[model samples]
Target: MSRYPDVYKSWQSNPEAFWAEAAKAVDWFKPADRVFDASQGAYGRWFAGATCNAAHNCLDRHVAAGRGQQPAIIYDSPVTGTKRALTYAELLDEVEIFAAGLASLGVSKGDRVVIYMPMVPEVAIAMLATARLGAIHSVVFGGFAANELAVRLNDAKPKVIVSASCGVEPKAIIKYKPLLDSAIAMAAHKPEHCIILQRPMERAALIDGRDLDWSALVDDMRAQGAKAACVPVAATDPLYILYTSGSTGQPKGVVRDTGGYMVALMWTMKNLYGVEPGEVFWSASDVGWVVGHSYIIYGPLLHGNTTIIYEGKPVGTPDAGAFWRVLSEYKVASFFTAPTALRAIKKEDPTGSLISNYDLSHLRTLFLAGERADPDTVTWAEHALGIPVIDHWWQTETGWAITGNPIGLGALPVKPGSSTVPMPGYDIHILSDEGHPVPQRTLGNIVVKLPLPPGCLPALWNADERFGPSYTDEFPGFYKTADAGFRNEDGYLFIMGRTDDIINVAGHRLSTGAMEEVLASHKDVAECAVIGAADALKGELPMGFVVLKAGVTREHADIEREIVALVRERIGPVAAFKTVRVVARLPKTRSGKVLRGTMKKIADGIEYQVPPTIDDPAILAEIETVLSNRPVVG
Candidate 1:
């Protein structure tokens, strides 16, 4: 028997009591006056009237608990051939020193500091330091285009900008200082000071009055024995602001609160991830993403678990075995990554040969998120790793998993295409366009009930008015997930795809995700994407694009024919899945999400702006070329 039922039922019976019980694990300077006050903020506030410091909870508490010597961060950068680890005491020392450096630069409580740096230990230090001072930090992805960075700069209006001289990529060294300089020049809200970490790989020329050297400032503070004490802040205070990726103009900055976020992370570390203190947990994501914000930096540290800061790819950065090597060397207990990463590795090493090269004895569960994890990839991973391949569902707004298979409560049965049951706080519903409940196993809009659990975005940064319009107004009394899916009779969630990806063909709604799943099941197909292309008669039609596995020398035409037949047989002919194109690769975001919307626009001949988050702008041109010269097969 699983304990999940009782745990979930306990939450459903008394949500506030459930959360209040979880809050006891965290060391608070002052307890909450009320566990929850429904009349507080946009929806409601958790731990109202509480006082806490996030940095102290993540560092000082653990250090004071005698885990000071335990490794807090394991930084492994295959790209740089660099590997290092920092203990809790050492990490806290660095954060305090850096906090003093920021304090000297006039950064204090409520002030916003924008961090634009690569996946280095200093980035984590900067975030913790900002939190230590009761200030908010916004981390922009390193090496972002100048214009995109400028947009974030203008919106965030940071007082102090922390960045690096450059970021090293597999193929090239990206000079970040120049891009940072251009962004600063373009933005109307000029920051008072810019602190740049000059890497030996590429040194940057700093502006005399405006720029400061990161090492010099930290060294000066350390030499003087200067350390900033943690500043107590209200539980409702914003801890950080993370802007949604790929936003073009006037980005939506998601604000995460201090007390609620801390409590939630502590709970998730134990319950959702089944991770205990002093264990190694790796979330193979960048600091710029939500996964990094929660898992990589705060979650594991808050729970006293050693977190991995990996600066490498799933395939490159040496070879396809990079991830396995890190897992084996670090003895990672739980591993979390995006599905696209697994697909990339599976593409390069189709037989899972590279995975066998490393000893992943300590590896327990493999968690997949970011985008929908197709059944094919999930099955392949499960068979390859001999562990539960859990696919959870969430977004940047939620800041944590909405639905997941909790490893801590009790391991649940593996479901290939389902994102298990909803977590304790989330009350999921599959609703029709008219806002009525839909039947089980029927694809519909997915939404969560009001007063979303703690750790979710309280509101958009300085734009509380826009929050409702963007998220809530569409579905009254519910937070519109915008993704279409359905719940099975057994309560498992099957997220088909984004709501827009559901195409209307001859008066029938068909799922592109379902079609993609079918296409991916083909033996030769390594990965695939399905988009609803415009059709004059049917209104819309499903078009498939697939990338073949390595060493597959079969004819593209033959593989394409098989893919169409598979979809036709599985989903019936009403899917209208006719066009099949074999491409060198599918265009993806830096975070590895397929750019399906952009692909749809290109397929329909609509003008589209290149998304700032695209990994390679040249891939779009190649996709366009492939679409123009359509393969006359399927």
Candidate 2:
């Protein structure tokens, strides 16, 4: 009954033919000379020799197809108390005018434009407008520190910068213009011009002769009926340069091509998400991240589905009920978010009471990504919503999903911790340290056979030499995912954690994720993290940290004892999971990824730099105090 086996086989049989058939979904300006070119990029390039416009496909084609009246973007900001919808026609008009504004500033094909803004509709407009002129746009997360932004600026060397006055948070207004100015002042490369959007909450002082007002510029262009036509670019032309932080403290700008990206997104919108045109799809994420780029902006638009731009947290934009209200009001059919968001909501409500307050009949599926989705969180979400809580595996490098449950073809049986079968074009294999294929159900390194799928990053911007040493050189003829997981007999993939999370204990390799799963299953524990702490005898030993639920009044000592017993019973003593500690909160990135590596450094007593992406630096000090105050548990 499922089309997955055949579809996957079809791709495996002939990848080019499979992708060629999928390319029919998009409207290309010029047909590709080859389905794929082996001699082009690192490994290869998809849809080589083709000409296309990402913005045109995302905006103009929909407007011309009589779907202009449909809502293209619904901006929902619980923090600012603002909600507005822009139709396809209106959105297209806005983007074209903005494109013309950028053009007037001398931005042209191949020029890089750095966008530093919050979760506003203008961020999407900036990206699409840049793409409209065949320019590359790199969006830095608004919450990043000034030095981090400066690093990206130096690496990207954007010709122009687009930013806003401020970003509204739950309890405070962050003045972004100051941060943007500081970053520019710190960077070696200076942008020719800056377009600042002055919000009512905070008005920024614009630098004379170098800065332009966003409203005034765009309004003037609109008054003059200036609409920049979409420029045709080669399929291999870079659409955007998204910089992801590397372990070396240098940012790696990941390049995504236009035509191949569009094709991959279009295919996944229907097959992976199971959403149709005119329906609502909300990806509750920030525009600064890849999910926002692919889902909140491009994927839904290319599929003609209404997408929601949410500017609030999972818990405190008002309360835990915030997401449910948006889903009920917008009638969202397919919802996507990170598992950490669900964990926060579950920790707050604990009873699933907020969910029953709204009408959720229209909601069908919920997809979780961005990190490892623990079985506890998945089960909690499933029981709360009475719908499928699908945990899909992907990375920032790969724009879309590498493995997922293809609900469009037919819903596969739900496996609690496994991210169901690989989508077409991803030949996933589990390889040991020696590059030998491992046995089924044995944890090892996960890698994809090269000539990665269309939506994946081709290479790091201006770092072609580093790409090989960083990713492909470790294992020849494969793209290193850097994740350690296993494939079940049924072919489902279980992502234990990052490859580095696998610790050698007394000559046995154990997964910290597996131990964390046991810790999280305890009823009193809301969320947990497991890091391999350095041990003299065992090489490394697992240390557990957990945050308790909201209303739990139980003693921390009792709860910690129970968690240790659970892990010991489930994973056995070989895990060396003796150390356990209770913390008020886990330090996480703004995108909700727990900072486990930092915690490991603290436990090992090694000097560690505070990660720029951390949501709160103070939490790291709290973790340090907790580790220093108490001795390791038996």
Candidate 3:
């Protein structure tokens, strides 16, 4: 039986009333008069008449409920061998002091502040403090290059910038202040003030007049008896601007509103994660990304749950047992991570010995996102952990998960490669290139009906002109997702890959995900990525990059031949899978998304610029060397 069987009907009957009731879940100072306002075309407004503060709902309200001594954030950094937990009272004190410090620096409401800090407790503190003052925050990934940081600074034109001295890695230390200085020099618009969080591991040169010490400012504010108070603002006010890579090489800032984001994420905590107040919830992601902002900081905190802020890699900090240790130590009830992290652990410890060594009895459910979860990886995790491996799908534009099993509401049957049915507020459809519905099981564009849900991005920051053409212009009254997939008979949505990832061979479109799925099912293959290489006759031929399991010593040629035959037997000769190259590792971004486009460029002998988001830039050079040594096939 469907737990939320009547959800669609209730939403359809009166969306405004439904969302109005949902909005009451948060601590709003003034109730909303208008539920939704769409008079400004596709740029709609939610809770337009309401006034509230996000930080108040996330911190102060819980403290007022007599939960002041309860744990709010648990900081675990294996790289630095440091662990600390802050209760709600302690967090409020820190946030208030920081908020006062920002006020002393002349940071007022509506001012933009760029946060360039590592994944520590301070990142969350800075974000909440910025929100407390009604200022907008833009967090640049700590791993981003100076040029990338400059681009965001110039675009957002922040009045203040917050950063750490350095970031700690397992092998080396990343000096961040140098990068911040270089970025400030390169940017056209520079901030008036810069605050540096001094890390004990390494130090960088600080500017005299423009820079401020984090501890000095906070202590001064505390001594002066400065109080942090939430400044109420209209619900339609912009909360944060998160930049996402654009096809045109410019990062588009996705602007999320405060009212809608708060309501949506709070609902997600109970409905999607199946977590309640005081439960330990951990989302293994950085604070720089949307997943981190929504799940790690806002969602769990808003629901009064204790959120874990981890500062280390999945396998390297100590071993493959690092994640298990944290889960057991924290007694986490719900856990979320990316599939790429799981694949890395599987490659290192194939027998699941590391997972078996820990006591994970407290773990209730496991969720996967950020990338498509392969069936092999999902099945392995479900069998080894003995929990439901739920794979949900969403984008940076949407602040929360859009499709999943909805474990809190009676988890639906798991389909190996599918993201399952859409949530209540979403009306999803698979459309043809001509903007018409496609038949079931036929690949096409994924789109959502117009008037997107509350949590969806209202518009791009200062790019209102580009918003419509980028999202809705492709299909009238619909938001184009740019992903290619189809719906199954059971109403499950299967995302093959991005629309541009479709390989056209001999006038036929073949999904790389389909071929990769077959390759992953093989016993010898640990992980794989498929890309279309240039071919003179076929236009484009499928090329496979396979990462073999540990301790596999079979000849490369024999394994390649077996993979080719498997594709031919399963997907037929139309696939034209010409070459299979075994490689040590694949290039991935800091968020664990495979750089298939870069791989394709290398395979075709085409010169391409290395993306700044890549985790290890040297991996591309290794891939090029492997491609050059491989024998060509026609």
Candidate 4:
């Protein structure tokens, strides 16, 4: 056995002794029949036979223990220009109202709802409502354009879409209604009803008969005598479907069941983040995406720990000091942010004491993710904030923090830029192509060897539909994390870069699918292709090549500016585009894929074969014509 028995002892040494202790650490509804289901597969079940509702763990258990009055969330709305505090009791009340509203819509068990809104309180409401009704929610990052949104709408076939007029940003306003209209128009199965939340932003007049205002729905629910819809649910039932960027022409919707997600989330929050009751925890991420869905909404709530949701850009209406202002304003106990913000902040105002402006005396920990974290970035935050900057790692498919320097586990021994050992009981390893574990220091593909945490996703939404082809077909048995990295001898995991087409721009992890989704959002755009181009400024900049709707002029930087602003407003300023190239058409494969490789060659100044399947080879000439006029940023 290793010197640290808890650290190195094998499962064979004492199986029950290991997982049983972990299971007890987290709050569960009922005891599980079995902890590990080996007969099923490597990705077997956890907390089997356990009955748990995510909302229950998030509120009831903590509230029952007299922590109801404890802070649950501290919200910031740009319209209000003030921070609003919410206790667990108040949050529960709000969630209850929305849950009942979802019930009012006849959203029941098994129905899937799409939550396509920015980081707002309503986003939380939609998720809890789904969990409360036992309905699965598929949260597409609100940053996506209409065509992308339409594709997902067609795939998931949601019964309803909960959206907002706009999610605030440092940039221009994003009118979501138009996209909703376009997406709804194209979707194979249109939602029976559309629920829209009009932020303080000036939205176009609501579509008559088709859209219902959110405030009106809440009003109707209030007028009626309705109790909280805190419906109980099974652990194994589907909770949410988060789509990952697809390399094979289509996005893969990864489904994570309720019980498994709860187990993993609760464990990570308490252990990985070292969250304590009443301590303020904030993730500077929009609920439109996974970090927001898991940590910002579910994880902290499950723990009854106070969570902070900021509804503006990190550098909103002011300098980068805006983030520090929020940190100081809330006295956040722990803060998690992407490295992209840190890099831009550092690059622009190097050697400045923006960290000093914030009274982070309560700041115990800082976590970084959404991209491969640069070591220097974390070190910078540490020096500036005078706190431990914990660089963690996980993906939308993983659901919650997997490998992290768990601060609450005692004095955390951290290696800057390394995602510390896998959270307890998670068997993580770096393997070469053949599925064999590589030596500790050698770089290789990242894969989870043992049964992953309960927080891990429940395969693609249509598992039988696309399972053997996308995920399992490529790497059998072990769960493949599509990033390239290796574990250090110290057992800390380090992510190098993406093994997929996805690009990490300014710390925001966005797939080319998501980027293309942004470009296609333009009113004058038909289809779009986004590829990563070299940039010393951001390491990689998303260069969007778009096919415009007929009659749109190409010389107009107005469209480029609008698309860039659209991304900024939709996904926060972090995802803003570096270049928006208006191309006549996208290079394609014989099968109609957006010949991304050809785009890559164009980005790299190399000639490549464009398959005979390209719908209009002339579009390539248009792309070349446009590029001849622009300067390529190296």
**Model 1 clashing residue pairs (backbone):** none
Q: Per-residue CA lDDT of candidate 3, range 485-531, in tens? A: 98999889998888889989989989998999999988888899999
TM-scores of all predicted structures: 0.99, 0.99, 0.98, 0.78
Looking at model 3, which ten-residue stretch has the lowest summed lDDT? Answer: 1-10
Backbone clashes in model 3, listed as residue pairs: none
Q: What tens digits encode model 4's per-residue C-alpha lDDT throughout 555-590?
A: 657888888888877666676476787655566532
Return the TM-score for candidate 3, rounded to 2 decimals.
0.98
Q: Which has the better lDDT: candidate 1, or candidate 4?
A: 1
Positional deviation of residue 238's Cα in model 3 after best superposition, in angstroms: 0.9
lDDT, candidates in the order shown: 0.92, 0.92, 0.90, 0.70
State residue 208's C-alpha deviation in candidate 4, in Å: 4.9
Model 4 C-alpha lDDT versus the unseen true structure? 0.70
After superposition of all CA atoms, the RMSD between model 2 and the true structure is 1.1
